[model samples]
Target: MFKIEVAKMSILFSPITIGGVSLKNRIVMSPMGMNACKAEDGKVTNWHKIHYPSRAVGQVGLIMVEATAVSLDGRTDPDDLGIWEDGQISGLKELVDMVHEQGAKIGIQLCHGGRKSKIPGKIMAPSAIPYDENSIVPEAMTEEEMYEVIAAFKESARRAKQAGFDVLELHAAHGYLINQFLSPLSNKRGDKYGGNLENRYQFLKEVIHEIHKVWDGALFVRISATDYHPEGCSIDDYIVYGSMMKEQGVHFIDCSSGWIVPPNFSERPGPGYQVPFASQMKKEVQIPTGAVGLITSGLQAEKILVEGHADLIFIGQELLRDPYWPKRAAKELNVSIDAPPSYEYIWNK
Candidate 1:
């Protein structure tokens, strides 16, 4: 703990309310898979106990738990967390309680890896396409299979609520099952779940509908704003999806781009590379959005909010590097923030 000269008021340190849930600040810990379950059973483990609460203590306003499987076969990795069963609730509740005790809100990213699943079984996708040359060619999902997946998501949302999460995020990005359905590059079936953009959106629409039955809390949907290929989803397409999500009562859209299939970009990611997506969605859809991807530094995060480019700054790797990133941001912005009572002596000095 240390003291710094105060400057002007910082919007980065300002409180915000989304979907009736008030957060202490706008900084969100973007979900990043830890693969730490160790048992491959998807139960919360000792690693989760230590990893999540540390950030809460460090003062992150909202911590989104990593992509957690809705079903065993939906797991991105064998050891990824799960909310598919009642047995998982107790462990998850314990983790949520720890974070709440430290005065931070916690959310969980509900996901279905689809073709990307590492579990030892045949994976299912909207179409029978493989993610890439080396990836497995997934079985095309039938109507019954699609219903099963939606039910899985519904059940997962129930479990997440029972486990005491403050928010629920649908993992619709990064070429996962929902992304596969949303992007034309991967979905090619000639049914109601395919063809036009609205058709492709049918699956996610139903999932959201079912989840809303059990969850009336702040709901967020993470999306790959662009497929990065001309044949794939474009920004205009996501604008429509964003509008749909807004109408469906989604509180926020976590804007991230690419990985709908594979990387096709010529340039590497730069700072705030994905901020424009959030800006576009926010303006066009009239919905609050979170900008993710490579946004580091308090000034940079503040700039995004200041310009009305995004409502929330979703920090990923930066938070991993420094759990006390909120403190660093406060210091950089020259704004004073409260430290835990245990560290107040040194912080006040």
Candidate 2:
């Protein structure tokens, strides 16, 4: 059922299994902050149902929900969905079910905003550096507080399971709680949680341990492959961190970059800017990885897979701008896609 036409570059449409979850194709719908939650307590809302099922109907392999706060205090926006409460599970369950019905797998991204924590006005970080003036200063988490956050992550994963999500994506990227731990420029603590790569990775490793116990599903981790700042997290550090994450049973490293700091020349920014990061990680670390960043074309995405640059490609804005991106791609590349017999008349000819 799958042919890896390397020369014709058709591997992008091949089936692959991540951890134990099989994907219909290699295309993933990467998480983008929609901030569309409408429930008072920030539970997944009807908008989520509408948002994700459409992607599945469009034929993407994996649909990763936006950053979901593991704790109330960790929320990045009032509208951001939260897994901290059991009340939020059923709505999300409905959303996941809808996606599955469309023959798509759904993953929920668990996150802690740290200094970027946009819980009302409260933010908590590894240090006091502000994410924005309007953003909360976020008192450094004490050991007790840190432990609480870890528990929070575990509980969130438990809730996600109860919601019937297929995967758990740890949002360790973008200068959030986990990113704060990894960045020397952000983490100034002299404690075991801050000084070196091992120390910086400690909190995340433990969080993974916690979530891992509760989530029997594939556990994917998103990483900023480059800090994009000369003084910040580096490619060297990223590889070290990726190796540690792999040892922790992370199923795939979703390659992303530059949210922890401003863009730097070190980051080769443009279309497919972050593909090299995924390529290098897969080559050196030998772990399954996903490439995401301005991936806009069927051929462009296919080349990444054909050349072994990434195991998966995610289309963000492109899909949003055109919910039928998959169908269009199928047509462009002369590939067949599944559509119910009733809808054949409605397909873009």
Which prediction has the highest lDDT against the true structure? 1
lDDT of 2 by residue, 59-88 (tens): 888999999988877888777888888898
User: lDDT values of the candidates?
Assistant: 0.92, 0.84
Model 1 scores worst on lDDT over the 10 consecutive residues at 1-10
lDDT at 256, model 1: 96
For model 1 the TM-score comes to 0.97
Per-residue alpha-carbon lDDT of candidate 1 for residues 266-307, written as tens digits (9 for 90 to 100): 888888889999999999999999999988898888888888
Give the Cα error of residue 188 in candidate 2, in Å. Answer: 0.9
* Each prediction's TM-score versus the true structure: 0.97, 0.94
- Least accurate stretch of 10 residues (summed lDDT) in model 2? 1-10
Error of 2 at 267 (Å): 9.9
lDDT of 1: 0.92
